[model samples]
Target: MDTPKIELTKDGSNTLVHPKYNAHYHSTAGAIIESDFVYIKSGLDFFIESTQTNSVSVLEIGFGSGLNAINTYRYAMEHEVFVEYIGVEKYPISLEVVQQLNFLNFFSIEDKEKVFIEMHQSIENKNLNFSEFFNFKKSFQDFSTINSLNQYDVIYFDAFAPNDQPELWTENLFSKMYASLKPNGVLVTYCAQGHARRAMQAAGFSVKRIPGPPSKRHITRAVKI
Candidate 1:
């Protein structure tokens, strides 16, 4: 892992470019927009609609820049949904970098900067009640060490690409992910690679390709069977 340098996506949102991975932390087309389509609409909203549940638990791999976390928190506040999120990041970014992002401009809430800063700087492993509807915890560890079984309703697999982080996108890891989710729980990711899909299928998931965000052809959503 390397210190990711900040860059602007097509949607004018900030994203980080990892030198070691040689990849953008998010899509070059858009950061927040991509998250909205893949993570929020496909994962969170889809789970809520299918299960008719007011509360949902989510596991996010590669919590870089806290982009997805803040987006999820904002969504929960807007929709009055209760969200319990676990954000896993082995190499956490500094609060100084987090503050440089323009994510707060996307929301209308008061003290958005303060809230976002707090989330980025939160203590690792301890649950933080961020709001009435959103509870967050920063799991300061490697994604491979995740051991939560049959726990989360949805997973935002936001890790780097397979070519960059091959170990994270494997059958063995997918098996763990399958075990980490409740029956029928889903895992959504920007990746639609054949290897990833096969690995998910091999791990007992029902995988499918769905329409992607702008500038992308497809993404994967794997469901626990």
Candidate 2:
């Protein structure tokens, strides 16, 4: 993939549109505008908020530009909750490009820059524990072929849209994810394609259709029942 074109939005948010991925951060209209839409509105908030467990483990299919991770970190901080955020991404972005994404300003204190750098650099495929509020493992591989089961409390299935990558949305892939989640764990996505919903159902997820943000009409959330 080509280097993404880095640009700033009117709200001073960063956006990177590469030939393969158009990732946007910190804007109201971009790809990753709000956690409410990308995570919360998709019912991730409900799972995270309602869980009584001391430590919550999340498995993200595509870490992408780290927008979901960043937002989840902020949420954990605000709620004083413990989280273990694991993600898988086949094509990891360069460290420099990751730095250019500017996640520090999302927090209130200027010292957040140090924490941001630490968190971003700590992501590795091997298991790593970072403090009480955060920990992550980056599986530098495809999600469909992942072989773990009954590990995660929440799964953020935020792959590129089915139109962009159909292979990631198939029934077989959802079946893999279905086995990956702990019983009653939730999986959320911004996609609501009919086939995708059917695939989730076929994989044994109790799916729900929810309202989406802006241009999108619907999003999907599934519980491993």
Point to the candidate with the largest TM-score: 1
lDDT of 1 by residue, 1-225 (tens): 556789999999888888776789889899989999999999999999999999999999989888898899889999999999999988888776777888788888755777788778888888888789998898888888888889999999999999989999999999999999999899999999999999999999999999999999999999997
Candidate 2 residue-wise lDDT, 1-225, digit = tens: 567666765445665665664544233355445444757445556775666665678888877677777677776776767888887877766778878875456556333556555555654666555556766666777776788889887888877777778899999999999998898899988888999999999999999988877766778889988
Q: Give the Cα error of residue 202 in candidate 1, in Å.
A: 0.2
Residue 32 alpha-carbon offset, candidate 1, angstroms: 1.2
- The C-alpha local distance difference test score for the whole of candidate 1 amounts to 0.90
Scored by Cα lDDT, where does model 2 land?
Answer: 0.73
Which residue segments of model 1 deviate by more than 4 Å? none
Clashing pairs in 1: none
TM-score of 1: 0.97
Each model's lDDT comes to 0.90, 0.73
Q: Which 10 consecutive residues of model 1 have the lowest summed lDDT?
A: 106-115
